[model samples]
Every structure is written in structure tokens, then in C-alpha cells.
Target: MVVILGGSLAAACAAPGSGNAQPTAAASSAPALSSAPTCGTEPVTMKGYFETGFPIAKALTDEFTKQHPNVTFDIREDQFAVITQNAPRVLADDPPDLMRLPQVSELVKNNLLKNLDEYAKVFGWDKWPPSQLQQMRMAPGGAVRGEGSLYAMGLNFSMTGVFYNKKLAAQIGMTTPPATLADLDAAMAKAKEAGLAPIAQFNGGATGGLAFPLQDLMASYGPAAPINDWIFQKPGATIDTPTNLQATQHLEKWIKAGYFWKDVNAVDYATMMSRFMKGDGLFMFNGDWESGNLDKQMPGDVGFFLMPPVQAGGKQAAMSAPLTFGVGANAKNADCAATFLDWVATDTQARTIGVQIGGSHPMGPADAPMPPIAPGTVTESTLAAGAKIAEDNGSMDFIANATGAIYAKSWTPNLQKLVGGEQTPEGLLKSVQADYVSQVKGG
Candidate 1:
């Protein structure tokens, strides 16, 4: 996302969209000081199903149990695909207290999630910025997201961008990361000449790893609102636009230039990451969530940067989303689950642990400081990129989140076709847009 460093970081450390002033005025000033709602000392055991595994939730629970010593958790972690696929059965048979809800609109439509409006009120969550509150809302019958009553909240904020191997960049005679799309092309050409994979990619399993960058490039050409409107399935929104076509053409151009790994389609996520860590590639187009792993495996050698703007100094935009979750309507410990969910925002210990362990931006109130990331580290760099996105309000939801089945049904397979020589950029976009039309129209 595009952030002028000073303004973005300032916004990150204060209220988003608010002009300079007190960083700790709203909810951050007042801790979790609402009524002492009780979940009893009966050893409240909550079963949590998550798309994200142990680290984030575990950290929160570790701190949460300190306040409510009677609470215990039985958390079941799974890959996003598995949890999303099983959501129906899980909800039908016996639902966990906290369930990662990817198809939040669908569940809300089915009335399977506990409406969080009451909890939002009790926690004083209305005090947060309007933009954040909007993301959590959905209209009655779940026909629309980004408005109405709250259904879910993200555990941690996330950002996506390019992760570059600084050492590799320097070896190619690059003094700094690219400042524009043209600069990126030059760097890629240089990396190619140096026998480096300019873009470390894996399209064999999921196209999101590749497609999201393209989407970000498209976003850079226009305002963030249209992209967000399309993703949120806003009325009259269309993805078959000129700028997105340019983005798709650009992806094809990179493919033809041999910028991506030749065997990218055969590689998997783990292998792609392993290769990037081993310095086999100059750049990896992905997200900040991977910062924790890169920090562990490739310390000091890596850095993160947003895709340069289309022009030398234009605004940048990228897809971002909260690591979202919901309470099950049938959950036994629903009250306890709501309490835990509320703590993610109101509790300082939870916020600190979220940043430190998850490399996540905060989902807390305006006055909350950006995570105390250290200087000159990749984590700090990524957080800076994220801070800018927040500051500029440049982030839009991931396009894949547009619909429950869009990734498997549309994004990945169509992108694979585009890169595999079976589809034109225009053809591929039409194909994906067709699916969106069908989904929205119930055709």
C-alpha cells in the first residue's frame, strides 16, 4: 500500500485518517473497563477452529487466562482450505466457540454465527475508526459485507507486498529497491541477466501468490475504492476494467520475459519459500505474515517493499485483510468466546503478543502504537509498509475473499491458464469476471 513514510508511520502509531495529535485519546486510553462480565470459575473450555495455527491465538490465550483463570481452551488448527471446507459440518454437528469464518457472508446468511453487535457495544468497539468498523459489519441476510451488524473480527491485521533478498539485489548492482513499475522491470531484467529468478513464484498449488501482486499492480493504476468495491461485491462493481486488463497484460509480459522461475508451476509454497530463503531468487511477491518465518530463516539478508507505483512517485495499493474470526451460534462457551474476542482489542498484553509473535499490524484502537519492532529488520520494514497502507487508507480486501469458492473455482485455475499459454490476459480476466457475474447473479 502507498504510504509516504512519515505520514504512514505517524498514522500507524495513531488513529487512522486522523490528523496529527494525541496518539492515546480514545479506547487505548481506557483499558477494558466495561462491566466485569463473568464466565464463571467453572473451567470454561472453548474449542477454537482457526485458519491460523498456534502462535497468534496461543499467545492471546496465554494472556487471557491470566485474567479469567477459570478459562481453558481446546484449539484445533488447520490449513485454511480444510477449515473452510469443513465449516458446514462443524457448524451443523457441534460448533466450536471460535471458528475462523472465511465465507463470513454465507454463515451470516445461514444464521450460523452469533451476531456480534451486543459484544461490540459492551466492549466499546464503536469507538474505533469508522473504516475498521465497516469491515466487520454485514447487512441482514448477509447479502452485503462492510456494513450493518458485526459478524466477525480479525485477530490480527495483515499486509501483502514484495519480499526482496537485499544481498541478491546488491549483487545485481541495485542500490535500492525499485521506485516504479519501470524500475522493477529494470531490476527484473538485471536479475535475469545475473541468472537469478526475478520473481520467486509457485503457481502449481495456488495462484493467489502470483495473482495478488498483479491485483496490487492494477490497484496502483486507480483509486483503492473501486478495487475494494469489486471485492466487497458492491452493486454495479465490475472487475473487467481497463486498469485490471493492463495488470493482466503486465503479468503476461513478465512471464514472457522469463522473470518468473521456469518451473514455477511445478513448485509448491514450501519449496518456493525454501528457495527464496536460500537466496535462489531476488524477490518473492507475497505477504507480511511470512515475516516471522523469514526472520527465523534468513535474518539480515531480506527486506520488504511495496510494488513500486506505476509512475515514479504515484500512490501504491495492495490487498490486505484482518485475520478474521467469528463465534459459533451453537457454541457452548459463546460468552467466554466473545470475552476472548473482545480482549484481542482491549487488552494490551494481547496486542503486544500479536505483533511480536505474529508480525501482525494491530487491530486495536487509534491511540495504539505500532508494534515495537526493532530498527533495520525485515519485520520493521514490513511493518513500515503496512503502516503506510494504514496511513494512506490504501488497503483493500484480498480479491479472493470476494466469494467463498473464488480461489479454487476462479483465481488459481484461470491464472494458471494465463501463465501456461492457454489464455490471453483479456480472456483470463473475462473468464474470472464471468464467474463473479454468475456467483453474484446466482446463475
Candidate 2:
């Protein structure tokens, strides 16, 4: 009855999760949102590639077409693992008109994307928030703040939180979602003792489901030095320190205890979610964006709780990387594409996609009145304003973004071993650090 990872839908009409408050109050005078794009007469065919099979991606395609009736659109969807893994090959062969990428600066550093700062100005881009502009800065070797010329625009962002079932919790004698790290540990133990699979994770998406958050927690409790060092390029950085040791040590405890799915890292996306949606796994952790997808998958039984802090101040924080983080530098229809991505910020696009699919808005509240999976389910936005949260909570960049994603790509195998108790966290950390350092030195 138990297998992979999962969660619920955001009911917020405007907010990201349960639709609460705007992260940054825009100056109410930003043109009341664009009057929806209207360019049917001069339609241009644009090819766009992004993460695979979701309502938002499809909604984006539909909404863009609605305003630009004449434009023939070519949309490509795939997993981040595949596309980023084959970034060079994809760019060289088809050279799509536009691409959805992470860390636009990386593209600029590699000279793969075109700079859109000037064009952004002509498009009245300043009306957009500063927090949004940070993605496009033109700084070099910026391991921190993702500095580089603005070559990308994130459609919206999602954060990590706990997804649980209240009904099931009560059945298992565990009440609400666990709030503290120790609470989490206790809840997992209870679920297992009750013969219910407690924490469900898809190991195949290890880079996201595991590696990304584990490292973020490492930054939360231990030295901000290693994480901060990546951004500021601190000297003599080492992951083999106490910070990583502590993070990995805690993780091993859970791994050994059957808190997460065995061979979780080995599970594929389809199987993982399929089992999860069936209520097989008691809790799952992921971005609020999954609200829509999870709603479709599991309906009424799903709910989200902020990522519990590892320590006292660590509660309700997120471990996240923005979705749809890029635009093609040499995009033939750069102007149109840039404007479209930017509009996604204020427009009803994210909400609409989430609404139809039962998701959380990337930046807005999840108060939208939508059909529920069960008679009584929480339909709230799971997303908070990405920019604001990053600043207030201290954001950490994934190693993949640094060192050109080599570690992100290689992490799954090692993590699978770690979670399975085949590799010690210390051992895994040492090898990864050594390999990363060698690569960085060569540069």
C-alpha cells in the first residue's frame, strides 16, 4: 500500500499556498497588470522547452496562445535531469527559440544565452520588483545571488514543506503535521509502528527530493560558511566539516529507521507519485507548485506545512530552486518571450493553472475556489513570494548551480547508497567535496 512521494492542492485564488499575503506589496500602480497580450496578426512560431508534464506548463502554452492568436507555438517538456544533462547538445542541435533554464547567469557565463537587460527596459521592465531583477544581474563568477546579465525570468517559485493527511494521522494516533524536527522523527516512528509507511520520497528526483533540502538543512544548523562560501567564494571551503557531518548524520538516523521509503531514490517519477497519491506514504516534502499536480494525483487528503527548521529558528523555512528560471539568450522572439514570462508574475496564469489542476500559486495565495478532491480538503496556496522568503530566511544555492551541476547530476547514486546505509554521510560528503574541488581547481 506504500511506495513513493506525494501531497495536496492549494485552494488560494491568488496566493501561492492557501492564498494568504503578497510577499512584496507591488506599488499598486504597475499598470493594473497588462491587458492580456494581443498579437494574433503577426504570429511567430516559438519553441519552448521546460520540465515535463504539468498543468502550469500547458497553461502557459494556452494563455500565451490566447493573447497571441496568430502565433504558432511549439512546446517541449522533459525532466530537468534530462534537459540540463544534455544542455549543450540541445542548444546546438535545435537551438529552440526559447528555453526554460535555471540560473540564467550560468548561460551567460557559458556564453549560451543572450542578454535582455536593454530590451527589458524598453518593455517597462522596471515596473517589475527588484527581487525579480536579481535573477538577471550581469555579474561574473557569481556563486552568490546568481549574478549575471539578466538572461532569464522565473515564471514563479515553489518552496519545500511537509505534505500530510489529517485523516490518516488521526487514524495512526498522530494528530496534525509535525512541526519540529524531533516531532518529525517521532511521527515517523509512530507511523512505522502502526504499519503505515511514514515518509514517502521519490528517490529518482534525488537532486530535488533529497540532495537539495539535505544541503539546505546543513546550511541552516551548521556553518553558513560553506553555503555562504559558495556565493561569496570564501577561501578553503570544505563540506567535510561539522556542518555537513551534522546534516548527514541526522539524515542517516532517519534513513536507518525506515522513515523514508527504502530504495526511494531508485523510484521513478510515475511509480513514486502514483503510489503516493494513493495515500500510501504518510508525508512528502516538495515545492508548493506541486499543489496542482498533487491535487490531480491525491485530491482531498493532501496538506502542506512549512519546512520545519532543523533548529529553533529553522522551522517553516524552504529548500527551493525556482521553476522556469530562464529564457533563451538568443531567443528569436526574445521580446515576446520575456514579456510573457514577466506577465506570469501578476497575471492569473499561475492561479488558473493551479485552479484547474488543484495547485498552489507560485507567488499568490491559494484561496481560489476550486473543486476539491474530497468533500472537505484544504485548498490553499502552498507558495510564498520567492524573493522575499529567500532574503528573510537566507537562501542556499544548489551545488548543481555551482560547479556546473556536476554534483547534482552525480548525487543520486551516492545518496541512494547513503539512504540505504551502504555509504556513510561522512564518506559521501568527502568524495563529493574532493571531486568538486578538483573540478573547481581546474577552472
Off by over 4 Å in 2: 1-41, 76-79, 90-94, 102-106, 119-138, 141-145, 204-209, 219-238, 311-316, 349-351, 354-360, 363-381, 384-391, 394-400, 405-409
Give me the runs in candidate 1 sitting further than 4 Å from their true place. Answer: 1-42, 52-54, 206-208
lDDT of each: 0.78, 0.58
- Cα deviation of 258, candidate 2, in Å: 2.4
Model 1: lDDT equals 0.78
lDDT of 2 at 120: 54
Clashes per candidate, residues 3 or more apart or on different chains = 0, 48
- Candidate 1's displacement at residue 318, Å, is 1.8
Worst 10 residues of 2 by lDDT: 22-31
Reference-based TM-score of each model: 0.88, 0.75
lDDT of 2 at 429: 82
Q: Which candidate is the best by lDDT?
A: 1
| Model 2, residue 279: C-alpha shift (Å) | 2.7
